[model samples]
Target: MTNHKVDTPSKIEWTELYNQLLDKVDVGIHVIDEHGKTILYNQKMMEIESMESDDVLDKDLLEVFKFHNNQHSTLVQSLQTGKTTKSKKQTYFNNKGQEITTVNDTFPLLQGDRIVGAVEIAKDVTQLEKVIKENVLRKQNTKFTFNRIIGQSEMFKSVIEEAKRATRTSSSVMIIGETGTGKELFAQSIHNGSSRSTKPFLTQNCAAIPDSLMEGLLFGTKKGAFTGAVDRPGLFEQADGGTLLLDEINSLDPALQTKLLRVIQEKSIRRVGDTKDKQVDVRIIATINEDPLDAIAANRLRKDLYYRLSVVSLLIPPLRDRKEDLSLLANSFIDKYNAMFQMNVKGLSEDAMQMLYQHDWPGNVRELEHTIEGTMNLLIEEELITAQSLPTKFRRRYQNSQSSIPEIDYPSLSQDEEIKPLRDKMTEVERMYIQQTLEANDHNISQTAKILGISRQSLQYRLKKYHL
Candidate 1:
């Protein structure tokens, strides 16, 4: 009879298991009793608040936790009404007194029909909020759109329309342009207009990193894989579920280019020194100053990689090629610098605009930006940036409407006046100049030599032989 009744734990065991699972979870968790007294707090919650379980338990919620004013009222209301409320709240402050933002979920805990307590779960959202704020600021600060591309030419308009249409698809895109032609801005606009607008759009400059480090940086590395590696994920991993922009993709070394090709084809990457592969769902957008096809031909880039990257290729014209855009771009930069440096400079004069148009802008848009900034710094009272304020090189190169030399006029020689032989005419002129110099110096050979930029002995010999 005693051996017949060894029973297993029932619903109580399941409830206890659930509580254990919540306690071991990574998110902060807490429970408050009907009297608004905190009854239980998991380890994560205690660590986040930097307090002990005993210090928080049996204390009133408002007194136990440091919640912002608005969050405190909302949480109290949710508990009193036995309703569930989810919102972002600032609840904890670090030791340095910096507030930590958290996404919190508060739900009423019921004992049958009566509400016994409330459970709150919070996730740290500080980084996410910071990113959102930064994106908002970037959008507000820049006039980056299809219309703001600074070109009215038909070719430029066609390119913008093509880029906008490409953004609708999830296919890979390659943007080719020279330096300072706003390739990065074009990439940003495409990502912003894409269907994945809400997701992250990250960029990596391929030319900025060394070859050996680039592999690890793009694909990430495991802890202790290298000198300072601490199990970090790379840009490709970070950009998973969104778009990854590879700026200066042509600068990537051949080895890394091959790996990138694999990533693009396979949609998976194994971190350096890691055996397991990670699946990444991302849209790839690559930009380069040089032609990827040329790079492939030169063996600097993998052919397969180039083909994979250029599934849809878009070319951004250099500013010089888009002469019509010069005025628009210049005014945009002037407006920006005017607001930035707090200057009263109005705009460029007609002559100045003409000078800018005529000059071959070797540095493209970036050069124009610097030139405008320099003019603003030097300009004090002049509201308009005139041709006079432009740098000497810019003015000199573009000044002449036609040939810079003036027209010449000559008088006809008389037939009666025997035109001296060409050589005899030059000899007479030379003799007269030497005699005049010697007389001016009182016949001092050294002084005359110095004046004529010749040796004293040579001057004395010439004077004696010529009988001057």
Candidate 2:
């Protein structure tokens, strides 16, 4: 026993493992020394900032990225003050003039009682900004009315009635449901049913938006507020005398929620970079994809703001919870699409309807609608949708649930089919595993990556390679 030798990893080996672990995380990780020089930059951070290790390693933060001032940089501010900056949204330009926005949480690394360096965790929202901008530009007036809402279930009808009652008053309304459960549809119907239906109806999704930009987007912006800034009306102003739908209100920054609470209390708004408070009579109808209590417990939503916005809260049941309406909804969607495509397609076959009922419908009604639409695309001479005609994604799920054997782990090869090379067979197996894992996680890239035991970057590469 005394002569037995134990093998342990060396310091260098441990360091290499630590670095690899950092690169696997979905968010960007950056570390800087007290002198503001980059010490450790992970792979995700490099991808997010569009720079390589050669451009950032051992370089000053100011030299690598363009910030208005030292104070504007979260890592720098944390280093100088030895204070933490949590979930602060920052927008800055890289050396290539490409604007990057990230939600950052920075902490000062300390040695005993002295600050030594700082580490930052950032989540990029640059693409989200572009999507929000495009959506805003393409926004049209509300077209959904209560009459257009299709649901015959008693529970569904009760919620519809509650929403109808909400339209009679100007009080704030909160619609709660899971994603794709038709929260926005209910929101639009409420706006159209209200007395202020003739007025402008505006919608803004608060999720994944930077706070700085969100502030100006919600409140008006004053002239010369920032570079190229002009006087512009925000959602509150645009939706004046009408309803403003704030989708996923919990996603809004806590500070912005405080401002919103004040607005609801005073019925007024103060533009960004302006001192004057202007009155607005916009009715607020907010939506949340989770339980409000959970959002408050997690500190994602402010409690006081929830009370102000939920004067008339309506909860929409998930599709699985109210399966009585499944056939009604499916037939409606089929008729709508058939009219749009100018095709006469009959209703779903018994097996097809059984497949629909077998699913828990994690995506709810919207998922069912999309399933029908996708199945329709595969139809040519077939007038009715059979179980065999469903999209591969849905069909595979049904098959896997019914099969005793795990078809997922081993791809089926027909005896008469041509044999493929080992490389091609392995590639096909890898692609299938990635696709199934992605579907299991509801197409969430980060979660899918984690489930697949790979980095988000690697998962994205596979998605592009397989066109999944």
Candidate 3:
């Protein structure tokens, strides 16, 4: 044809482009075929494993990657379920025998209708210094204030007023709440609002550190006390003239709790190897995830220690008792997730909001925040959170509740077109809603019928009629 030139991409061009793109990504990327043989990977994976691609390629991942063979491994779970697993913290040994700790998000890669393989994106958490620095930065950025503890309910209001009064003095504060309630938020707010706000504010989760290590971490350790132990200041010393938060204080061992009571009473502490007591001016703030009386009864917390810490107490009510605040909390979370995930989610739909209101939030505010963030991540193509669009975990929970099932929105017809009979329109709407409910429950006929509030036979008839 008149010297026409058609430009066709070479097979090598696409492979080179894909490899270049993979290498440019910052996080570790690993891909394995259906047989678990390493098919393609990037430079970052090699760096994380301390191995070259040539050595790993064509090898069975389970045999080469020590983490792959484990039952709890996300990659293995993805292969079994053909589903994506996100942000699972895992610790494993590499090929070089070096231990590695990372947060991995793995997904099953699909080609058309078949699962071709799986891919994982990994973020290293083994670097303690980096993780610590990031935590410090995050704490600094959030900088909790009194106004940030959002709730307008009278009970919450009374608690806030009492909390503000606690900030005016150096008295010890005891914050009691169930897990996932905003115990730490109140602690941080109290510390930041106090006159010693500019001073060193430190927080330690008492439940996290072992009893043997807890003593040295809360009270300084001196040289010769233990092998290779150098003289060092602990949290009480480091947080001098500021606030020290002992989170989950009920987890403290009986012996350690006695020592803690002594320190609080005398306002001093002695190093593990030292013979003399050293004076300190740190204000203690202890939080417990259980009732103080119950904890004392169970011997989990000391009665004397509880009295010292409860000089000023703040008891946060559970979410179920604060239904008046659900809408407010939901809107606040929506705003937060909008900024966090960089999306423009306007608000929750009526059914979605109703679902939230009806369900008892056992995990409290933290759980709500996580749900919002996760739902926002899944709403890539939408601006609002609807009942149908909620994550399966929440959807199933909501469906199990006694609340009415949410119906899908039916399309409106134009006046120029022939209008269907009322019965036909209703049938179409009902069928569509049933189909959505069935999909949400992964086509479990019994569960679908239960969620839809109908007999199994009726659900079966509809499913057959709809050919779904």
Best by lDDT: 2
- State the lDDT of candidate 1 residue by residue for 1-468, as single tens digits: 466777877999988887788789778887888888887788877665666788778888676556554455345556799888665365555434556666577888888989888888875545434544554455344435566667776446767888899888889998887788888778777877888676767776788665766787778877555423446677678777778888888788987888898998899998998999999988999987865655777887777877888888777766766688888888999999999998888899988998898876768899999999988888888899998898887777776763455687966888888888966776677679999998999987768978986544345435653679
TM-score of 2: 0.60
- Candidate 1 local accuracy as lDDT? 0.75
Model 2, poorest ten-residue lDDT window? 453-462
Error of 1 at 290 (Å): 1.5
lDDT of candidate model 2 versus the reference? 0.83
Tens-digit per-residue lDDT, 6-63, candidate 2: 9989999999999999999878999999799999999989888998998998999988
**348 in model 2: Cα distance from truth in Å?**
0.3
Q: Which of candidates 2 and 3 reaches a greater lDDT?
A: 2
lDDT measured at residue 347 in model 1 versus the true structure, 0 to 100: 90
Q: Candidate 2, which segments miss by more than 4 Å at Cα? A: 1-139, 399-468
lDDT of each: 0.75, 0.83, 0.79
